[model samples]
Target: MTDFRLVIVSAGVSDPSSTRLLADRATQRVSSLAEKRGHTVTTTVIDLRELLPELPAAMSSQLLGPRFTRAVDALVRADGLVVASPVYKAGLSGLFTSFFQVIDNDLLIGKPVILGATAGTARHALVVDEEMRALFAYLRTLPVPTSLFASTEDWTDKALGARIERAGRELVLLMESGFARAVRDESWDSYQHSYGSAGGTELDIDLSSDMMRLATGGSLRDSDDDPFDPRRA
Candidate 1:
């Protein structure tokens, strides 16, 4: 049986947060479904509240504390992800967005992810699909077709559970297909990646390139070449 790693990032701030509750439910379903498919699933939970102390440093100086470092490590190794956030002022929690904003741009590329969000009122239900999906899209993550959003009333509603089940199954199917891993293994170079990005595992560099030479204070043209010649320029 193939083994898969799943990471759950919960931006819940309360002890019994609905946000985390939603995320946990999704995680459980995904695990169960994957197990039924004869796959082993390992999970890592990253509670964003625990990383609050590191957020400022991460945002200000790009310094990752121990917990933040661990979070990034978990994300890098994750085969699939369940990300849940709380809504505030008609938008996603600042803590939720901030944490992702500080990570490498290519860290989540091609990774299968499920978007979930919790808000007090049903009015904010669209936040997950409208805002959170956009953020994951920018990271180039492959979010499942089903998105989960829960309001206070949705907690007891059967519809929320249905969505969670659908999302979980979708995630499991995507993971089983190994789409993300295949994309990374086969077409990784086709994607745009910044230097030292992807949690610093992307170390490939072409020393002979003009950009590299210029960055290292090396001249593109040799001393023997004519300085003003268009052919040598």
Candidate 2:
């Protein structure tokens, strides 16, 4: 059996928020699905509300403290993620966005993510696809095909449960198939730009490329006299 690590991030503010409820349901469903597929799943839930005080420091310094660092580490190491947040004024919670903002841009590359959101009105359901998907796309995370959005009315709707299960199954399948790891191992470097790479150096560039030759005005050559040539440097 394969071992899978799943991290659930709940960005709910209130003590008994619907956002957290959705996250819990999603996590449980995903865990159950993974178990059924003969994979052992270990889940960690991070409540962003608990780290509110530290957020200011994290945002200002652009650094994660010990507690938040541990949370981020869990996220980075996880095989899959369930991220849920409450919608406020047609946008995601600032706390939710702030928590993610401090994370390294490359940390979530190719990780499988299941996006979810809770709002008081059904009109905000699109927040899951429009805002949350956009955010995860920026991080280069592979969000599952199904996304869950829970509105006040959706709690009593049986369809909500179906959607949750569908999303969970998709995430479990992605995990079991090892697609995330394959993408990360094979194509991650191709997706990443040389600047600010994880190793703190640019990828090897071909000076013979038309772009490089044009940028150097065709003056750069392979000889040692060409100071701009990386080989000479």
Candidate 3:
């Protein structure tokens, strides 16, 4: 059986939050679907509320502590992710956004992500599509076509369950197909646009160009025997 790791990030603040409930429902469905497809799935859930105290340090210092690091590492190593947040001010939670802000930009590139959101009313449902999707897009993650949004009333609605199953199925199919892995393996170098990438340099510059030559203090052709001698004017 294929081994898969799934990470669920729930940005719920309450003791028994609707956001976490929605995330749990999605994770259960995805796990079931993967099992049906002959894959063994392991899941890790990160509740951002628990890490709230460390967020300010992470954001300001741009460094993650051991606890926060472990959470981000789980996300980096995950084959798929279910990210859920509670909507505030008609958008995603600030805590949710801050948690992601400390992670490396390239960490989630080409990874499959299932976006979810919860709010008090259906009027805030579009936050999943507009806000959450845009955030994952910026990270270069492949968010499934079916996004899940749960309002307070949706907790008892059968249609919410159906949508959860649909979104879960899409995530499972993508994981089974190995689409994210293949893309990361084949085109990773092309996506490297900053330091510490596998490519060693940004892709936009040509190392052999005149600008690069000048930047590197000219070519290695001018070799003077005297160490103290300057170049002849």
Best by lDDT: 1
Q: Over the stretch 1-233, how does candidate 1's per-residue lDDT look in tens digits?
A: 78999999999999999899999999999999999999999999999999999999999999999999999999999999999999999999999999999999999999999999999999998898899999999999999999999999998899988999999999999988888889989999888887888988788886777878667765667646747644454
Ranking according to lDDT, highest score first: 1, 2, 3
Q: Relative to the unseen true structure, what is the Cα RMSD of model 2?
A: 4.7
Q: Model 2, 66-153: lDDT tens per residue?
A: 7787787787678999999999999999999988887777778788899999999999989989999999999888899999999999
The CA lDDT of each predicted structure is 0.93, 0.86, 0.85
Backbone clashes in model 2, listed as residue pairs: none
Single out the weakest 10-residue window by summed lDDT for candidate 1: 223-232
Which scores higher on TM-score, 1 or 3?
A: 1
All models, RMSD in angstroms? 2.8, 4.7, 5.4
Two-way TM-score contest, 1 vs 2, winner: 1
Model 2 score (lDDT): 0.86
| TM-score between candidate 1 and the true structure | 0.92
Ranking by TM-score: 1, 3, 2
